[model samples]
Target: MRHVYGWLLLTPAAILLIAFTHFPTLATVYESLFSKGSTIRPSRFTGFSNYESMMEDPVFWKVLTNNFWFAVGTIPLSVGLAIAMALLVNRTLPGRSLLRLAYFTPTILPMIAVANIWLFFYSPDIGLIDQILGSFGIAGHNWLGDPDTVLPAIILMTVWKEAGFFMIFYLAALQHFPEELEEAATLEGASRWYYFRRVVFPLLMPTTLFVLINAVLNSFKLVDHLFVLTKGGPNNASNLLLYYIYENAFSYFDTNYAATLTVVLLVILAVLALAQFFFLDRRIHYR
Candidate 1:
């Protein structure tokens, strides 16, 4: 009777998971093997043709490279800033609550709003950043227009947006640490840096690991900002893999190819997530 009740309890969640998550994943994989159908031509099994085409597509390669650089640029910087902000706010300081709220303000704003705000900042001459530059008789360059600057501009915005959310996790972790640890370190004449590096950091590894995985996922999944700020534009220079997948699925109406791209993305994320767990799990000191 207990086993029957247990099965009954598990059934709803299992059904939901299968219906929404597992089934879609399997369907995408299955769809990737077929060609896109139209009114004139029907869908047919292509058996990896879409994948082969993806390999040959230059835009795919460009988008993949952009995503790699985007991750490289955003993750470490965001994590570092998050840790710094957490440490600063975690200390007993005047107006720390306000400081924490200010740091976190960007995170709560919609990405579209963030993008529009930065879009104004990136606008030529009349924009805030440009106006500041112009004060020194410097000419304003279009931050989002130039291919060289667009990705970096986006990176900066992303770091600003994401760091505070990560900081919340770090702050929570810091809150749980016993004050005695800091007191003991001080009694031993341990410097702040030394204490943090040796004691506090080691203990925070689990939180760091959690934050890192989420950061990686967010790096790839973030697309709303792109839609508003650049539309992956100025010659697709700022295009990331997810936005490219969206273009293929919606703009080009090539859902089959989109499925292939999604599979690749899924594979990349799975590999990265698994690697992080496998490597970092060993170092995490769980409390």
Candidate 2:
């Protein structure tokens, strides 16, 4: 009866998972296979039509392109900044704790809150960013309103917000590095860069991989702030895949098509996840 009791203990969580998460995803897949609108009662088994239609939809293609750039723009920038911040904060210095807190404060704040603050920063007249640019006799450009600048502006804020959180991951990795290995290199008269490249970096490889995967995932999932700031436009300029999916389901009531878009997103995420795992398996230093 011990085995039976163990299964019973697991039942509640299993039921909740199936009820909430698993069931909804499966339902989306089911819905994507059907005709959502263009019907009286909704749903007809027009297998693969929804997916095929996305290929031809110009708006869908545009949003898909936007999402690709969003991911490309955010992940590397965030990861690079995060690693740099981690290194800086790891040192013993005056005001180190305050610096850490300042960097990390954005990470804990709600994204909507950050969006509101950044909206002010991007304000055309007196906003901090434009105001600073104005000092040099440069015209104060509307950062978020311009198609060329919107994604990059959002990417900059996102990097600042995400970097400090990832820094904590690196800090933990830094703390656990075997002192002996570093000391051996130092005793051998190795330069600072040489020590970092040959000794410290190899040890932190696992943390780097973990943070990269998380940063990549965030690039796709964390587009909520864009809703408040961009609403996916100055002519859909900031339209990401998730925001586009939201537009379809709620704004346009194209539930069937939205379901299909969701499937595409899931496929994209799945591919990234697999790539992350493949790289991690090769890169992580087990010792």
Candidate 3:
């Protein structure tokens, strides 16, 4: 009777997982093996044809490279800033609450709205950055218009937007940490930096792992701001894989190719998850 009741309780969630996650993944894989249909032409099986085309597509390669750089640029910087912000705000300094709020406010705002605000900040000569540089006799340069600067500009905004949210996780970990360790370290005349490096950091490894995984996933998944900010402009300089998938599926009406892109994304995420479990989990110290 208990087993029966347990199965009954699990049924709805299992159904939902299968319906939404498993089914869609399988469907995407199925679709990626075929050719796209049109008004006059019908869909047909062309095994691995889409994948071959994806390999041949220069735009796909560009977007994939962009995503790699995007992840590389955003993850470490955002996570480091998050740790710094958490440490700063964790202390009972003057107006600490206000400082915390200020740090966290960007996380709560919609990315579209934030992107719009940043658009002005990146505008050529009229932007806030240019205006500030003008006072120092520094000539203003186009921030987003140039391919060299566009990806970096997007990365900077992403770090600013994501850092605070990661900070909350770090702060929670810090709060739950045992204060006795700090006291002992203080009695031993250990410097703050030494104590943090030796004692505090090891204990926070689990939280760091969690935040790192989240940052990696966000680096790939979060493309809402890109729509408003650049639309992958300046000759696809700022394009991301997810945004490219959107372009193919909706804008170009190429669902099969989009499915192929999605399959690649799924494989990347799966490999990342497996790596975290196998490699990263071993290094994390859990209490």
Candidate 3 clashes between residue pairs 3 or more apart in a chain or in different chains: none
- 1-287, model 3: which lDDT tens digit per residue? 99999999999999999999999999999999999999898999999999999999999999999999999999999999899999999988999999999999999999999999999999989999999999899999999989999999999999999999999989988998788988999999999999989998888788888888878888889999889988998899999999999999999999999999999999999987996786565533354
Candidate 2 TM-score, C-alpha based: 0.92
Poorest stretch of ten by lDDT in candidate 3: 278-287
Return whichever of 2 and 3 wins on TM-score. Answer: 3
Model 3 stretches astray by more than 4 angstroms: 1-4, 279-287
lDDT of 1 by residue, 1-287 (tens): 99999999999999999999999999999999999999999999999899899999999999999998998999999999999999999999999999999999998999999999999999988999999999999999999999999999999999999999999989988989999999999999999999989998988888888888888889899999999999998899999999999999999999999999999999988897787778666533354
Candidate 2's displacement at residue 115, Å, is: 0.6
The reply for model 1, stretches above 4 Å from the true place, is 276-287
The clash numbers for all candidates, in the given order, read 0, 0, 0
Provide the overall lDDT of each model, using Cα atoms, as 2-decimal numbers: 0.92, 0.84, 0.92
Q: Give per-residue CA lDDT, model 2, range 26-140, as digits (tens).
A: 8889999988766567567999999888888888888888877877888877777777788788878999999989988888999999999899999787899878888987889
> Where is the poorest 10-residue window by lDDT in model 2?
278-287
Better of 1 and 3 by TM-score: 1
